[model samples]
Target: MQEIHPLLQPKKYRFIDQSTLGPGFSALQSFAMDDALSISVGEQISPTAARLWVHHNTIVLGIPDARLPYIDKGMDYLHEAGYEVIIRNSGGLAVVLDEGVMNLSLIFPNSKDLNIHEGYDAMVEFVRFLFADLTDEIEAYEITQSYCPGKYDLSIGGKKFAGISQRRVKQGSAVQIYLDVTGSGYERAALLKHFYEISKLGEETRFEYPTIDPSVMASLNELLGTSLTVEDVRERILKQLSEFSEAVVTHPLEGEEIEWFTKRLDQMIVRNEKARENLK
Candidate 1:
């Protein structure tokens, strides 16, 4: 496994530890941060980055999630039930996030010669390495019963605790994954399942939706039988990143990057508005 990871050889890596940014923030704030990082990488003004984030009571939806028959009602339900909803410009269906959910995005160059598999492999390897001390039983396989199930879903003992997604902009790619580090996996899965049931309302669509199984999801705290908080995992990520490379660079969005993010966020807001309007 070590042989496979170092072989990929990303040019440079930056690790952003944003896990302490409270339990909740606006989706636009997070999008702005990603946009800033994307611009930096695309311009070759910065190295590759592994960013960690966590948000509370938020339901991040895919483009299709907004098209459900009663999605407007669902969004209202989510709001009434205390969850902020937003559409991500990436792959995957709706996912629940809270203080327990840790999100990491591996940002890398996307040149003509760069292989897509390289990005995917890098994430899979990084995750395995982070938890090497805990257990080596984690496997990369499709956990269909899990919400937002995908081929690259990260699982342990056939129960999913993480899902991977990717977003590319110009010459930069951000491979994203959300790790359920702690809290009630059933509660989270139930949230997503209810979101689907309320939104889709048995409506048939061209895309096949996931039939979320609450049983197939488990938090690190539950899976390991040890209480592991998101902060603990965040620290582990920093430690692993520091161990993996020399001179790990950590910094917030620069002024120049912030300007670019502002522009990108406006575009994101426009896209989100369209999605919301569709639901209405």
Candidate 2:
């Protein structure tokens, strides 16, 4: 196994887990929270932080996804299907978030000196370490037929189970990943596939959206043949963090961090509304 990146070797890490917050925890707040942590870490007010979040039955779309010719209809279809849709402030196509999916964010400072691929590699290495005991077959490569496909997509046996995205703010970087811990990955992919089908309507567009193949995706439980819940993965993450750092401290947002979160949340709301309206 490759050595973990130095960025992952911090002496202390601030840990925040929001996975059990239930249905009210919106993806918007999650993104804003990451931004606040990024700014705090970049300014040296806080140590490098790792946050865990989960949103129920929501579809987070990339900025370009808003430009689909018939996005309004697609949004309606998702809403009618009991899913909340929002545009994320990061790069990546649409991805499904549900009780079965777990999202993790690692915020690091001095991003100016950090290569983009280095940040990604840190995440890849950490995940592989987390599941090293279960299987060593995890691979990082573009799973072209999966929803939110990217070069950093994590897969096993050519079937994707996770996708990663990164956002930078105030010289700090947040490397975010969504892992399909438990559930039917095919159902999730089929949802996004139908979304693109309705949104594009076969209309030729400049930005090419992925042609999702639901069969190319599977949850960890399905692939590993072990029933692991989101909470199980959450425990594994905290355990690994403790082993990697001198101390893993559970901390809540305080002082200026709360103010930063409020501002970032407002910005995200405005950005989302404008993107949706422009498409309409």
Candidate 3:
């Protein structure tokens, strides 16, 4: 008998699935939603949340990537490749997003006992449990050659399939993960490689970026040898959360939460504006 993760206990949870909301919400809006939701949960107005979201063609950049010497050139390349670019308020390098990818944000009330690594570990355990029937080989470690490399990167058989990042607001912890569900992971990896090649131009920079190798990344469908779609993965998450929680409620943002989201959205817009102005 394997030990169960604390996150998987039968507790109450709020489920929000924005994956089918289409392309109307930008990455900026999504981040704002996460922040606002975190605040709500922290204030005890809501329960822990498991939000699922998907965006069309977009490349979410980290602050460090925005500071690249030739970031303007990189943005141009991404734009030419038919990707909308935004700098995310998170800790990580560039990551690709598409219809085939699914993003999950697990928001919890921050506690003195819940450290940063513990939050990440909870997400890792949740994911592994979600797919336990399909495979038991999921592992979390930094894949050095993959973009957005981190100690908590989720991989299997030495190829990375997902990455996780964390954000905290008030007393809420939003642990986020993006899963490459379907499509060509290599192509996405190659796009970032080209962006980096143009952005860095072999310049000796103070910040060290990962040397991306396209082959080091792979979609879950490719790794698991199944025709897994984003919808399939989304359903897996919902079903697992239902099994883990005594009650999984779906609710919309209310008046005060909407106000908070509005303010955070404005901040996101301002942040993007600054990033774009730098590209000029």
Candidate 4:
């Protein structure tokens, strides 16, 4: 689907703008809240949430990321290096998160008519339109050598700056993405590459994971040849959401949502524990 056609599918997205949250409680809380909100508000609410959040010096790893042969060593490396590594209950592999990185979650109610590809396409289309003013060359193809390579890896000129993943709770689908708004994307890639090397240590596994070439990643500031900050992209995100919605209102996690998050947080911790065990 191209520009005009996809924009026509204006699914109402909620605006949970928390663009300046740090490590520990804030990141964990927001993720758990949104994960639970996606399920509780799925079909009944039919409300899609567009959340913007940032965490400093954190590495959000995928479920499979913990399956790396050298995971213990990898996590140790990251921890010793002063990065907080946590396993995310979403799709995609390990990705660096910091104040410079901006994350958006487009939560949609899953209709019987919608499949996984459609869910992925909705975000692909939303993102394409989100940056329509900048350039139309953004392609959603698998950028090999890019960490977390998938069909939804959004790239410009062969270098990837954004990756999208999905989380389904009941009938709600949360398509989340981490945009490397600023900073050294190559540095992040290098870190993942090192993580892989430390984990694998030349041992073979059936999973067939990525070796990460570091060169295939770069920040939007580097790609655009201009100094653009996460706040700049954050503004662009708000403007784009307004263009697609009937009303753009800021909402917080309700008490019920908080309770669901508490439960989900426990599940997330369990998943993280199991993930960490796989590294050994």
Judging by TM-score against the true structure, name the best candidate.
Answer: 2
- The alpha-carbon deviation from the true structure for residue 245 of candidate 1, after best TM-score superposition, in angstroms, is 1.0
Q: Model 4, range 126-223, lDDT digits (tens) per residue?
A: 77887777778888899889888988999999999999888777877777888887889999999889988898899989877887999999988788
Candidate 4 global CA lDDT score: 0.79
TM-score of 4: 0.92
Better of 1 and 3 by lDDT: 3
The positional error of residue 164 in candidate 1, measured at the CA in angstroms, is 0.6
* Candidate 2 error regions (>4 Å): none
Question: TM-score per candidate, in order?
Answer: 0.94, 0.98, 0.97, 0.92
Clashing pairs in 2: none
**1 or 4, greater by lDDT:** 1
Q: Which candidate has the highest lDDT of all? A: 2
RMSD of 1: 1.8
Q: Tell me the deviation in Å of residue 7 in model 1.
A: 7.5
Segments in model 1 whose C-alpha atoms lie over 4 Å from true places: 7-12
TM-score (C-alpha) between model 2 and the true structure: 0.98
lDDT of candidate 1 over 146-179, digit per residue (tens): 8888888998999899988877777887788899
**Every candidate's CA RMSD:** 1.8, 0.9, 1.2, 2.2
Q: Which stretch of 10 consecutive residues in model 3 shows the poorest summed lDDT?
A: 1-10
